[model samples]
Target: MIGDRLKMLRKEKGLTMKEIGEIIGVSDAAWTKYEKNRAEPSIESLIKIADYFQVSLDFLLGRTNIREPQFVEEANIQSEFLKEFEWSKIGDPSQMYFLVENLSTSIRKYNEHKVTELELQLLLKTISDVVLYFNTLAELKEKYKSITKEVLTEHRKTLSQIIEDLNNILEEAYKDILDGKK
Candidate 1:
């Protein structure tokens, strides 16, 4: 599967086996062997090939039809979490796609605006925090499915604290922007 996919991607890109070998830090003979499925690539080489092809390992391995790699801190845990939850039932799945698109747009705008290093750093940190906040919520949901009143209260408190911290960061960021404009 990996070999076939690799060959297809290379052909699609109009690259020769030698070019791909150079790009992936492998010899041309090794590349040919990979294409023929005569030799298997090491995990590191597989990752390099996947990165070069901008494909998911699962897709390359034929384990999944999905091409995009999932971004997660813990793939095994998240896969289990995903199996138990239907996120689309809670909200439109398309909204998540838009959320990612919006983040990319936001970063592009920030770059275009040529924001100061401090502001860019703060924005990046806040983005990281937002991801962490959601992960925390998911973890909470996964950990305590029973959701007793006490547990619910604790979860609310935790979420509220995180929100407050995020708000503080945003306020400081806004203040910096306003000060810069003044």
Candidate 2:
């Protein structure tokens, strides 16, 4: 399963197994073993392979077909809102189809934004930072699922605050526009 998926992804990306092996600092024979299911790489090596292929470890291990988990589902909804706003900006009836085609390309990208290790690390670090910042919040500690949950919850709260602030700013800007205040 792993080998077949890797081959399919490599072919889809117009890459050869040798090229992938070289990128991950493995010999062609070793790569062949991996591709043929004769050998399995270590966790670290598997991570490297997944990174080189721009896929996820779950995919490399045959645990999942998806390259990335749903980290950007909310972002996708936001993109839809932006696309609608873009359509409203383009008033010409003849331009509507063209705008839709352009929007489709953008939506495809938005939906395919895979969460890489670097992104995951950054997210974890941000969460850690938040937890460190609010270490004294005793009640918050009990609400957490784990020590990591404290961090994650803090991160989520911070993000929610930022989003709320942004919405407030946008509302104020819209009010100004309505009042002809530029």
Candidate 3:
């Protein structure tokens, strides 16, 4: 999947393998191997490739067909009301993106016979729970407008702690999933 995307992107730019290799500081043969799926680039190299192409890591990894990052889309909002809203803070898009990548990895493992159906289901459930909790926290903050200032402040503090806890849970889950894969 990655190899195909790399080849396509390289061709789209009218770049030869050697040219791209020089740009990425890798040998032409190594670049060819990546395109052929015979070798995978290190995470550092992957970042370099994505950066050089001006594409998102998700797109380079074949996790999304969309070339633009979600944040880019968010930044293009034209409404003044929406522009004032810090949507990214309410639901940390970076965390969501990381979760998406983990889910994609789990699905791919399941498809490749690397993980059991039950494992995949558990991962899906964990992800669903995290999203539900995170969104609920966001909703509570926005929906409690009539509450006393003191109460609202306390709620906000509590909500922030809960969000942090949820984030820790997600990070641990992601580590567990990747560790299990290894």
Off by over 4 Å in 3: 70-182
**Candidate 2 TM-score, C-alpha based:** 0.39
Q: Least accurate stretch of 10 residues (summed lDDT) in model 2? A: 114-123
Model 2, 1-182: lDDT tens digits are 88777678768888777887787788878878877888887788887877776776776777656676342344456568667866788665446556556545644544576433343344345545555546645556666656676667766877775565556545544665878888
Per-residue accuracy of model 3 over 67-97 as CA lDDT, tens digit each:
8766445434423434344464666555555
Candidate 2 Cα outliers beyond 4 Å, as residue runs: 69-182
Candidate 3 residue pairs that clash: none
RMSD of candidates 1 onward, in order: 8.2, 15.7, 14.9
TM-score of each: 0.44, 0.39, 0.41
Over 5-54, each residue of candidate 1 has an lDDT whose tens digit, in order, gives 88998999999999999999999999999999999888998999888888
Instruction: Indicate whether candidate 1 or candidate 2 has the larger TM-score.
Output: 1
* Candidate with better lDDT, 1 vs 2: 1
Ranking by TM-score: 1, 3, 2
